[model samples]
Target: MDTITVKRRVMMPIRAGDVMAEFISFQGDRSGKEHIGISFEGKTPSFASHVPLVRLHSECLTGDVFGSGRCDCGEQLDEAIDLINQEGGYILYLRQEGRGIGLYAKLEAYALQDKGFDTYQANDMLNLPEDGRDFRIAAQMLKALGVSKIRLLTNNPDKARQLIMYGIDITEQVPTKVHVNQYNHHYLKTKADRKCHTMTFDD
Candidate 1:
């Protein structure tokens, strides 16, 4: 396990629309990841699950903040945020740009994808892992926040598997809304086929 134990640093109240939340920050001993937790107020809870809705969202600068149509990162993030705001849960925002390949290498891989290769092949061309991401830090963050079991919101199975390996019980899985565009259709296909993600696209 290469993950460092994270300790709770600060928790402050923040409001988004009618939703009130507590923004939590964690300090890692060695890991250099900016991990955070957003715990919204339980105004209208999801009694169907009887647990908080949790999402482990990796930071995608181009797609998340900039709304790049190259992928569904930003759109899925919006969905998770809205879900949390409504039903009250947590969103663990992890600083893993390009699935931990970082921003520069991600753009480099994108260049390769434009040259007629799928996402996995693009990473292979760049001498990078297909998905260089680790979810143990998210597990650590959840543990520090006193959340051992949750209803996970994600599309990638790896996220849920890794968290389970770290002992977080996944009560349910909330799939992210699929946003397929011409720019990211092939990319998403590669993910579903090669990465074992739970998605079916008409491609």
Candidate 2:
């Protein structure tokens, strides 16, 4: 396997309503999408400690884009951006939509979910892994940015393993706080029950 390299990086202003941030785009070979997008709270060339607040957010077109209530992904993305805007950190927005199953497949899985199958079971019925996302690319992006130690903002423990495998040091695991509606409560529970996600909030 090839060690992912940063092909290009550019500093740009990012505005999410009243929340303003500066982000550096890390482009890889695949192009047209974010391999990694790091949004910081303050000015560039930060004087903060080596252990930065980092969030490895995989792409979720359904939730992150359309604000679908079927899952907590959109809420998580919004929360991550808001927190990073305050705390000063990097939100590595990776292009691993639907846990790497892509958009159309995820919609199909949603149909299966409506048929009473849970998220993982739906993926299983589709012959896909419950979670196909790989955080090694996130690790590589962190290394490229010269960030090794991080307070990883996530609930998934597998993210830690994948980063460790790629030599990234996780100083802390910060579980994401999300707004759970009736539509996503069971989805979140399925994550906690079947996928081993650490969920602290009551659903």
Candidate No. with top TM-score: 1
How far in Å is the alpha carbon of 139 misplaced in model 2? 0.6
What is the C-alpha local distance difference test score of each model?
A: 0.82, 0.78
Position 38, candidate 2: lDDT: 72
Reference-based TM-score of each model: 0.90, 0.87
Q: For residues 10-123, what per-residue lDDT tens digits would candidate 1 score against the true structure?
A: 455443344456777776536755677787765575584368889998899999879999999999988887887778778888899998999999999889888898888888
- The numbered model that scores best in lDDT is 1
Clashing pairs in 2: none
Worst 10 residues of 2 by lDDT: 41-50
TM-score for candidate 1? 0.90
For residues 9-30, could you state the per-residue lDDT of candidate 2 as single tens digits? Answer: 5566555346665455555535
Q: For each candidate in turn, give its C-alpha RMSD to the true structure in angstroms.
A: 2.4, 2.9
- Candidate 2, TM-score vs. the true structure? 0.87
